[model samples]
Target: MPLEFAPANADALPLHVIEQAGLDGWTESQPKSVVTWVRANNFTGSIGQVLLIPGADGAPVAALVGYGKPETRARKRFVLAAAAEKLPEGAWHVASGLPRDVAETEALGWLMTGYAFDRYKSQTPAKAGLVAPEGVDRTRVETLAAAEALIRDLVNTPAQDMGPDALQAAAEALAAEFGASCTAVVGDDLLTHNFPMIHAVGRAAVRAPRLIELRWGEAGPKLTLVGKGVCFDTGGLDIKPASGMLLMKKDMGGAANVLGLARMIMALGLRVQLRVLIPAVENAVAGNAFRPGDILTSRKGLTVEINNTDAEGRLVLADALALADEEAPDMVISMATLTGAARVAVGPDLAPFYTDDEGAAQALAEAAAGAADPVWRMPFHAPYEDLIEPGIADLDNAPGGGMAGSITAALFLRRFVAARYMHFDIFSWQQANAPGRSKGGFGQGPRALLAALPRILNL
Candidate 1:
């Protein structure tokens, strides 16, 4: 469903957001009849609770949504999203009470709650159009929400419909929409182009592997993004258990997220010479599949011993990062659903990012707070560098011990790029539903990056 904004003249119902502490003062402002009705209905201000204020006509004239108290951290972010989900179908506008920033967040939340992955399903979600609150940029909110929806759609799709070829198609479509130039070096061309690691990991799949590149903007500080696009990870020879393979389709979530961020950058016309690289592939089982013991040469000329074939995301990303680093862009951001260790450490809600730059880390933290996108900084611990080294090769694809899996993976990819880089180990799938996010594919790191780009690129 499209993210809807109410017209100025539209008869939008008023949405009053009240904190539990202010409930008494709020009731004083309400009509006696309405206040009595609310009391009779046992309406105490609770987070995510909603009360419909009735007019003389016996229809809801306004909505009173509880934001809990000021100390309620969970409601502090996207409090009004619950109202969006429960509100009767029609246009609604926030009533005056909220802080400007809070209102803006509420507006974005409303749009986010409208997202539904109905590609194969026939049931359309109920419409709850919201008017852009005062001081909120409607265009920016819509662009972000749409980009997130794009990410969700791409990751939610099954492997049969979201293979390597399909991923390229999605990238090309996004490029076309933004008037950006896009190209793909597919099949054996990956080898000819010196993306041998990418080629080696993906050569066994029926759908050939490819590097999808997109370029946008004419003049500005160069910003490059690299995403691992393993469409379906059967784990190659080190195949995952049946349970482990269930969500394999989301292995390409990194690619989807980068595309989503690319869409936002181009759509918002950010002043940056943006370049996106996605090594789209499927790590499938075949006679020619890359083996755990195989040592493959990367685009950067580093040899990696495949300690585990399941660790294919970093292989593809390494080659792409190398290609990205040749230009020596001001900054390169690489994202991937790389390791289960990340999930174990930070859980599914928070994206764990690694970078050596202190200023960039601070900016990311601030941006994450501002955008309501959660990210935790994981160290690029110099001590853990030894863990990635195997005696036989320049690096081990999978480290010896199970410890610091995310950090070791980051260290492996760090070998390829010379530019200031940040690596995000993200769990793209949401295991449970939340206010604005559903229990499906979700975008991580992009929103935080988007918020930080202005300062990071000095744009």
Candidate 2:
């Protein structure tokens, strides 16, 4: 369901946020009866704690939400998300005095916490609504929240329903909604069209592999996005153990995030020639499955030795990246759930991005901070270029020793594109639930990218 934003209502319940230091003063300002009730209930201003003030009519008059001590930094953004989830059904608005940006962030968080994947199971929709916070772009916040919901929904879906063809359909639907042109090069045609690596990786699956492309915008700087869309990864000939394959359904998270970001760009009507390329495939095992040690020539004519079939995400992405590079767009962003090493380096909450563009990197870092989408910049580390170099082929899909798995994987993909690029290695699935973030497929850098684009492109 799309996020709901209600018109401002004077009768809406007031949501007052209180820090530990100001709790006493806040209680003192209320009626003596309310203050006695608050003290009786032991309503200390601890983060995520909620206390509802009662009216003489026995209905809720206002809500007191704890912002924790000023020193607690972890619960900064999305501070009111938990309250949004816990508050009684009604129209609400922040009544506390807060900086515009902080109010915007908290308002966005309230909308985000309402998201629940109810595709299969019926769910009671959230009845609570928020009046658009003053000084916040209500439409932009709703658009972003909707885009993120799309990402999470797509990622949380099981492989049976979210296969390669379904992914293509999702892209086509998004394109149609935005008046963008959408097309797909499917099946054995991938070979004829020169996406050999993509074809090889997906040949064994019942669903055909496809290159889904969508183009929008008539003018401005060209921005291209490429995502690895491995719908279900079985590790091909190098099959993963049961535990390893448990969450493989989330392999298409990169594609989901790309589409999410694409939706944001088009919805916001950004002045940029936008192109999205997703190499949709299912890396399954079968008699015809591509094996490790196989050498495949990419669309760019660079040969790759597949040291591990499990490294198939980068292979498909290489071809797509090469296609994105052919036009030499002003900037290219590639996102993929390509390596576990990245998760080890930064954990699931922080996406690790690689780029040589310092200015763009700084802009993304700043944007991430403001958007509550954390991204850590990892060096492209030119020295690791040799690690991806195999004696038999121009590049190795999987390097030996595994010291810098994520770095080497980025280096391998870097060869396919010549334009200024940023690659995000995202662990799309959240292992545990957090405020405003459910334990399912998540969009890592799309929000950060959206925030950074205007500044980076000078829009």
Candidate 3:
């Protein structure tokens, strides 16, 4: 977004910073030397000890912000953003001493603070975008923020309008824009096309569930992206409480994320054969809905016992993953608003991903760090594999144990993937309101994944 308040960078900046500890009385002749020094340098003063400074023209210059000590965790950069909200609308840089990591995060926080979801509201008051101190690509930073914003809008929309058909339509629209091939196996065609699990999970909905496939890039390394597109999960036959159903619309956030990633990939013209698969469905409760205790056959030819209908996300993902696996693509990645356990484990800010490949994992971590959209690596512990066992089926969609709910969910999806796969169990919602991320639906992992792709396919 274009900044309402534009602040330009110059050759040199007059900085004002608060002195901490013993440095307070460096120039002791005057009581307000800190303020005087700040003014002399064309900067501002701090509050730990407030003092005013006169500039070259004998006028008040820039202001100084103080952090008594270093921010322990990187996330505390938001405190600086809160400070930015108060600073006068001008090109202002943090004239204080902070670590390189703190500086980067604070800059990101400033960008985030400039975010306002004014799709339905009036324009917000102008706020200037921050200027990175020495070395930072402002465009790359904004791309990550914009990707998250796009995913949030898609996930926050109601399922009535964001249903399977609409989801497929959205993918088609994106494919059309990028000159990609868009196709779908809709309704009964899912069975005809061997996507039994996907069809079974979505059969109850009146709008009909579908497997939307989009293929882009004709000559490059084949990369497949699959997402759990449960538009609104009602927990199938197992049924969820009223509270659990409240945020079900965001269940399809995985699809939203992948689609958002695709937009970035195509927009940047990344050199990779991008194939996006979204198994769009609404896990609604009805007479025809798939039931717990039922055995469903996945596209990979594995029979899965439905221990809990509430665990339907992985079931649909099973088929989609199986389809992606068939191509044995160079790389395959998937995202899903798959489990509450993930939320309980990591809260909402950091997304947890599981991958068996070390090289991919390292690349993803580096990209996440560079992009400022970090993801934590959760082990796909082999010992926990037994939790997903089924007595009468090849596997159990819902594991018998709840200890490693997120891990088991990833493991279940793993069963269908025969190639290099990275699975994300994302919370996909912001618990509280903050700058760009509203108090509702938010995209968690797309930006990181998008950033990592260039390395993944060696683009």
Candidate 4:
């Protein structure tokens, strides 16, 4: 996209951003022909309003995007980006009018607008592009955009090509790029190595199940990330209806998102000894698939009664979280597309997280807002602990009566480890297309997590 931008020269179109209050003064400085054009169009600089000033030859000489009202800008993060998509086909540079504090975020938003998933179908790339905005970190913005592309690409791929083996390859590729170490416990080796629940839940699929681990960095506080890698959930023996299967390809979104953060961390050289654990699997149904009423033992030695096979995501995540907690890392954070209850709680836009650490929670909330990545802190409410405990086994995979589903799921994962743990119940699919974010596998929480890490870990 940077390459697509018209070279920063006299030939490039200058893009001026205007607010309603400055409209008259801005017009006063323009040529009479341009002023008349602006007045005739009644361009008041409201959001999403675009206009082009033409020269005597009639080709566009300049372009402008409205910044809208102060209150309108306050309610949205990437308001200018939405208007960016509507600009005329040509290269442009931000000439003036972006506040210095927002310059970087808006520039990053422009880079985000460059994404297009062209794997299965050829896409006509956007002709319009922007050079790096003034006073912005070019390296940081590109790194973030590239990492985000990784998450979207991995999640966008179909389960046929993105199963456990492929997921392991992706992680190993990332590790190789950073000169880190990566290893996976695959198929029957999982049971031989004590990841019983992970093996059991994924055993029915023809594609083998595996536990992938990547290690990097040597000098700093330990940061461990555990992600649920359910590539495609057919809901095992409990079986979801056809409607429930449409976006199942994004079930592995959590793993993709964690890897996105890892990419940002390594690329930015954050001071942390990072360990990423992914339990990659396919929750498919076969005669031998793990079923309801089956009691399985987790890596942490907790027994879990499966009341619903559809709850297999937390089962795999449980084993991975247990493994992550073993070394007592400074922090353990797990991300997963875990439950529909989470979607009901906050809809599809906000990532809902659970943690008992107040200081860390506060830091993350503040950081998320600044990063333009919204995340809400849900409690690790102790009162809901009993809801996950089944009389028969030590825990219930799916508690009946389904109240506080997200909280109960978080509590169930909490039972596996004792650490400064935070869990994000994410809905990683973007249901509608918007500027900078197309309607497919989208990342949540990771950008916010990236922003908050320095403060949360005291780097």
Candidate 5:
């Protein structure tokens, strides 16, 4: 369901404040009192604890929530989200001493707590909900958060239920609802259709790989989005360790994100011809899997050596991107859960993108700042292009040295892209749990891109 953030009602929830520890004597005393009260009652905050005490009137007032071990916490980034998770169904105000910005960010984060992937499961009474905080752009926050939730849900599902055929089904369903046109080229037909690199990568998987395309809008500037949709990466013939292969289901996070972005764009009626391309594949192992040292041609007609079948994402993307590049749209952006190197560079929360367009970079920077969705821009270094050089072919899928792996990956992809483009290397899973972030699959980077779109496209 689309997320809805209603404007915070002022009259209904009149007085509230958010307070940090060590702020003042009352603030310091309140936390101690709350803790003491919890101990005396033999209640634990581990399962989440909340207590309501008498206020100025005879009626009960705002409650105190115990968020365990503030010192060990990494910034209490989503503590307010806990409130949404556990609070009873009702409207409430922030009544302590949180800074306006922090309070607002947390307010939006709280709404995320309501998400549940019950597609295959039955609903429980513990289902959560919340009203948007007062004086905030409820519509915008709901739109963005709901879009992100959609991305996370799609990525979290196991590959058996989310294979290339299923991915195409999803695209068709989404397109039908949004009045967009959807088309796909599947299986061996990929070769007949000139998506050679994509075909080579997924020929091994039982589920036929496909290039799912959706186009929406007209009478406006063009924006093309490409997503790496490796439904499950078994590292191809060069298999990964069991640990490395554990979460391969999330390999298609980029595909999920662009679909989520498509949802938002169509819902908002953005002023652009939005084209989404997703090359969905399962990088499984088999004799037919393209082997290392094999030369494969790309949609752009560039031959690449399979230096490592593990580098299959860029290969499939190369074909899809070459197709998108054919139009030289005003903006071409691609998202991928592509590299571990990116995680080392910027961690999971901050996605790293490469682009030579200064205006686009600055616009994204400013948009992220305003939206509180942060991102960092890496470079499309021409000098590093040599790293992708192959001894036997025009380019190598995986370079021997790990130095600048993410940047080199971007550079490799750059070889196939003819127009100005940006590539996002996202670590699409959350390592540790937080209020709104659960323990398993999660969305990354797309929210920042959504926030940046209006500014980048001058909407």
Candidate 6:
């Protein structure tokens, strides 16, 4: 079932969040039996500690969750969710002890804890529901979770079911729901439409490649989003080892996240003309697959030497970014699970983005902290621009020597983008399950961008 809020006025019991130092005083207000129960259970209010107090009737009358010390809380996100997961299946509300500034965030964390991707098996989540805390918008918080579920569902699907055609169908479905326009340029038509790089990277796969486009909201500042949609990367002619191919199904995580962001924007009726471009493909190995030495011309007329076929995500994105720049929208952003170097640099938890606009960067940084969606800004670094410039062609798909690889990949995509652009190198997969997050397809940057759009676009 979807994550939802319990009715504002339901038969919900009080849930108290306590700190270690204040535990004694908190218990003083409770009945003697409840205090005895809490003390006997050694409930010191460490972070995520769970303790339920029973009434004279021997039924749970209230619950307690430890908020822990300031330092413990500071080191983690979704602190409330840690304890929320341990609660029994029922409606819950934070009655007291949570700080005001964190009320909304904690409420959201509660909802996130309810997510479970059970599309294939019987992995149903506990039917735990949270009442929206005071001053938090339940509708907005729930909508965001639904949109996030869309990304998780799409990314969690195997490449066999989520090929280019399926991805395009997903986009069309979203466009239909919003009364927007959705279209695609597929297969040989990609060549006809001048998306040669996208075609070249995906032509080897049995499933045709496509540039999926969805447009919405005609009356506001134009913002275009480009996402890399490589459905399954076998690394083409330069195939990856078997171990590297295990998670290849998540290569389209960027497109999944973009569609998720699009859902957020359209659902809220945000005042902005939103255009989404996703270059959908599968970097599968085949007899006629584009080779390592092959040179492909992009829609922008820049030639890229394929030094490594594993670098195909950037190729497809280059064409899409060039197309996005043609309109010179107020802003253009590209999201891609583009490089392993990104994970090596900041690990899988952080979304690393690059942009030249200080205002937009600052706005995003501020919004990320508030949203609990962290993003780190990487520099364009003009001094290293030469790293992408291979002598054989205007650019090299993968520069030799892996030093600063994420930066080089960013610079390569930067060549095709001339608008006020930002690129997010997202992992888009949860490395491990913790708190509100699960161990499967996950989102990294959409929330931060969603929160920052208003300030960045003056919407």
For all candidates in order, the CA lDDT equals 0.89, 0.89, 0.76, 0.88, 0.77, 0.90
lDDT of 5 by residue, 1-459 (tens): 234543345323322332333223334456565456435755443214555554456454555454444563344456667655665554556555335565556666777666666767853322334455546666667776778777877887899899999888888988999899999999889888999888888899999999999999986878999999999999988999999998899999889889988988887778899999999999988888889889998878788988899989999998989999999888899999999899999888887888988988987887666455667999888898888997778898899877899999999988878787889898778776667776656666666677777777777
With a 3 Å backbone cut-off (N, CA, C), the pairs that clash in candidate 2 are none
Flag clash pairs in model 1.
none
Output the worst ten-in-a-row residue range by lDDT, candidate 1.
69-78
Cα error of candidate 4 at position 375, Å: 0.4
After superposing candidate 3, which stretches have Cα over 4 Å from the reference? Answer: 1-68, 73-80, 88-106, 119-126, 131-134
- Cα lDDT for residue 239, candidate 4: 92
Question: lDDT score, residue 325, model 2?
Answer: 95
Q: What tens-digit string does per-residue lDDT give for candidate 2 at 1-459?
A: 358677765468888888878888887777889899888888888878888998989899888888787577464558777667778887887788445767777777888878888989977545567888778898899999989999998999999999999999999999999999999999999989999999999999999999999999999999999998999999998899999999999999999999999999999999999999999999999999998888999999999998999999999999999999999899999999999999889888899999998899999999999888999999888988888889899999998896899999999898988899999999988787676777789889999999999877778
TM-score of 1: 0.98
TM-score of each model, paired residue for residue: 0.98, 0.98, 0.83, 0.96, 0.87, 0.98
Best by lDDT: 6
**Model 6 worst lDDT window (10 residues):** 119-128
Quote the positional error of residue 135 for candidate 4 in Å.
1.9
Q: Higher TM-score: candidate 4 or 5?
A: 4
Task: List pairs with backbone clashes in candidate 4.
Answer: none
Q: Give the TM-score of candidate 4.
A: 0.96
lDDT leaderboard ranking: 6, 2, 1, 4, 5, 3
lDDT measured at residue 412 in model 3 versus the true structure, 0 to 100: 84
Model 2 segments beyond 4 Å from truth? Answer: 75-77
- For residues 140-258, could you state the per-residue lDDT of candidate 3 as single tens digits? 55565556566777787788888999898889988898899999999999999999999899999898999999999987899899988999988988889999899999999999999
